[model samples]
Each structure stands twice: as structure tokens, then as C-alpha cells.
Target: MLNMQLANKYAKAIFEVAQDDGKIDEYGTDLKTVASEIDAHKELASFLVNPQIQPNAKKDLCAKLFKEELSVSVYNFLMLLIDKRREVLLQEIVREYQTLSNAAQNIIHAEVTVASALNEKQQAKLIEKLEESTGKKVVVRTKIDQSIIGGVVVKIGDRLIDGSIVRQMQSLQKQLMAN
Candidate 1:
């Protein structure tokens, strides 16, 4: 909880800076790249968070790895995290930043589960419907769960819309039992 709070604080500060510079998406891409690189390379992640290593050494390594890829403001932000010994929260900060960026851009993420994979047309239709209903741009992550038997289940944030055959059958069974 404490770590999340700290991450949010850092993310908000950088988000505000990005907003002012009209570079929110660019900064988000940079932060995501940095976080993913660290996650993909365990040794590098350890080195960044290791208290035994000197801050100058860590900053030097970061500069070599990301300076060319990231904008100046983002690169400086990375150095700031090293200076503050908060480099360990890089991934969480990136996530928080993405959440802020998505909200700012009026985009919402949805998880769609179906019995099988959705083809391009179907996926496009689903996104279109979700966008129309929510009045926000929709980004969907699709999953296949054969156990659902048929139909689809969509989850958007705290809301769930379950139209799966399994759920429908359950409802029918309950109604029969009640009758």
C-alpha cells in the first residue's frame, strides 16, 4: 500500500510534466520501455534496485541503456529515481502513469472472454459496440475459455457483462427450481 502510494505520487508528478509539455504519450512509451527492459533482464533490474551499488554507477548504466531511446525529460526522471532510491518502483510507476494517460485520453480497457478466438471483424464489432455504449475509446484484450461453451463475457473495470451459455443455463436452472 505504501509502495503504491509512493508510485502514484511519482507517476502523477511526471504525468503533470508530460501534460505541460504535451508529451504524455511519448513519456508513457519511454517509461513502458524502461520498465519492460528492466523486467526482461533480471540482472539489470537487480542492479538498479541494489543498495550496494553506487547511484552514479546506476545512473551511468541507465544513461547507456536508455538515454538514446528516451526523451531528455524522461531520462532525467530516471536519474531522479536513482537519486531518490526509488528505482525499485519503476514498474509500478509506469502502470500508474499509463492509467493516468488512458484516463486523460478518454480510453478504457476491456477484457473479452469467449469460447474461441474472435476474428478481425468480430473483434472490431465488439470494440465498436463497447465504445458506443461507454462513450469512450475501447481497447480490448481477448481470451478464450472453452468451458463457457458459447457466447461472450466482457469485463470493463468494475463492471461485468456475462452472456455466456454457462451463465444463461445456470439462470434457467434456478428459474426452473424456483417454479
Candidate 2:
């Protein structure tokens, strides 16, 4: 709980800084890059989060590792995290920052599952419908789930739209049993 608050604080601070500098997207990309690097290499992540490591060493290592990929402001932010001993929260911070960035850009992420991959026209139509219904730009991540049998299931935030053939068949079966 306390970690969440701290992550939100740091994320909001950097989000505002990026917004002011008109680099919200770039900073988000950099944050994801840093988080991915830490996630992909367990030893590197362990080193950063290790309490025994000196702050100076962590800061220097972070600077060296991301110097080419991150901008000056983002590099400084990494150092700040190290100094504050909050380097372990990088992944959470990145997630929160992305939430803020998406809200700022009026974007919503949707997970769409189908029995098979949607063609280009189908994808475009789905996105258009999702945007129209939500009144926000929709960014979809698609998954193929053959068990759905056909049709699609769209999940956005707390809402789930189950339009799958499997679900329909189950509903029909239940109704027939009741009758």
C-alpha cells in the first residue's frame, strides 16, 4: 500500500515533467525500455534493488546502462530513484506513468480475444466500434483463443463484452434446460 503511494508520487512527478517538456511519449518509451531491461535480466534487477549496493554505484551503473537510450531528464530521474532507494519500484512506476500518459492522451487499452486472428478490415472495424462506444481512442491487444469457437471477447477495464460463440452456445443450453 505504501509502495503504491510512493510509485504514484514518483510517476506523477515524472509525468508532469514529461508533459511540460512535450516528451510524454518519449519518456514513456524510455521508462518501458528501462523496465524491460530490468525485467529481462534478473541479475541486473537484483543488483539495482539490492540494499547492500551503494547508492553511488547504482546511480553510476544506471547512467552507464541507459545513457544512450534515455534523455537527460529521464537519466536524472533514474539517479533520483537510486538516491531515494526506490529503484525496486521501477516497474510499478512505469506502469503508473503509462496510465497517466494514456489518460492524458485520451486513450483506452482493450484486450480482444478471438478464435483466430482478425484480418485488417475486421481489426479496423472493431477498433472503430470500440472507439465509438467508449468515446476514446482504442488501442487493442489481440489474443487467439480457439476455445471461444468463433466471434470475439472484448475486455476494457471493469467491463467484459462476451460475444464469443462458446458463450452463446452455453447460454442457449441453459435456456433450453430451463424450458
Candidate 3:
């Protein structure tokens, strides 16, 4: 709960900074990069969050790791968190920041995976359906996933709409076995 409060504070700060610099898109990409970096390095994440590690050391390490990737404002903001003993909240902060950033800009990202690549007309139609369903501007990223066998799997935020033939076959097999 307290982490959420802190995250909101930091996220708002970042959003404002990005807006002022006209780097909202770049900042969004930067945040995702930072999050991915932390995700890829589990030991580093653990070390950063460990209470036994001195806060100053953590701050230095963070700065060193992200010096090239982060802007001065972002670096100072992260240092501020370290000074406040809130360095452990990076994951929550990143998550909340992304949520707020997306909402602020009315940006939504979705992905559609199908057994084969959709033709241009099919892509447009699928995007139209998503817009009708979501009632928002839909930016659909398309991908080909042959493992799907057939049909499509759509993901919007955390929700998944699976219309895949593989899943349908499994479901059908289950019902038949019960009979």
C-alpha cells in the first residue's frame, strides 16, 4: 500500500519531466528498457533491494549501471529514491509509472498473434473489431505464430482473448473424453 503511494509520487514526477522535455515517447521507451534490464539481471535486482547493502552503495551502483541509458533528470530522481530509502520500490515504481504514462497519453498497446501473417485487409478488419470492442484507438501489433496451428490470440493489456485452434481442440478433446 505504502509502495503504491510512493510509486504514484515518482511516476507523476517522471511523467511531468517527460512532458516538459517533449520526450514522452523516449522516456516511455527508457522506462521499459530499465525495467527489462532489471528483469534480465535477477542478482542485480536482489542486490539493489537487499537491506544489508548500504543505501549509498546501491545509489552508486544504480548510477553506474544506468549512467549511459538514463538522462540527468532520471538519474537524480533515482538518487532521490535511494536517499529516501525507497530504492527497493523500482519494480513497483516502473509499473505504476508505465500505467500513468499510458493513461496520460491515451496510449494503448495490443498484440495479435495468428497462425499465419494477416493480409493487409485482414489486419485492418481485426483492428476495426478491436476498436469497436475497446471503444478506444487501437494500435494492433501483428505477429505470426505457426504454433497456434490456426486462429488467433489477442492480448490487450493483461487480458487475453484466445481463439486458437490448438486450445479449441484440447477443449473439445476434454468434453469428448468426459462423454
Per-prediction TM-score:
0.97, 0.96, 0.70
lDDT of each: 0.97, 0.96, 0.83
> Which pairs clash (backbone N, Cα, C closer than 3 Å) in model 2?
none
lDDT of 1 by residue, 79-103 (tens): 9999999999999999999999999
- Best model number under TM-score: 1
| lDDT for predicted candidate 2 compared with the true structure | 0.96
Q: List candidate 2 stretches off by more than 4 Å.
A: none
Candidate with the larger lDDT of 2 and 3 = 2
Clash pairs detected, candidate 3? none
Which of 1 and 2 is ahead in lDDT? Answer: 1
How well does candidate 1 score on lDDT at residue 33?
Answer: 96
Pairs in steric clash, model 1: none
Better of 1 and 3 by TM-score: 1
What does candidate 2 score on TM? 0.96
Per-residue accuracy of model 2 over 1-179 as CA lDDT, tens digit each: 99999999999999999999999999999999999999999999999999999999988888789988898889889989999999988899999999999999999999999999999999999999999999999999999999999999999999999999999999999999999
Rate residue 62 of model 3 by lDDT: 83
Q: How many residue pairs clash in each candidate?
A: 0, 0, 0
lDDT of 3 by residue, 91-121 (tens): 7878877787777777677899999989999
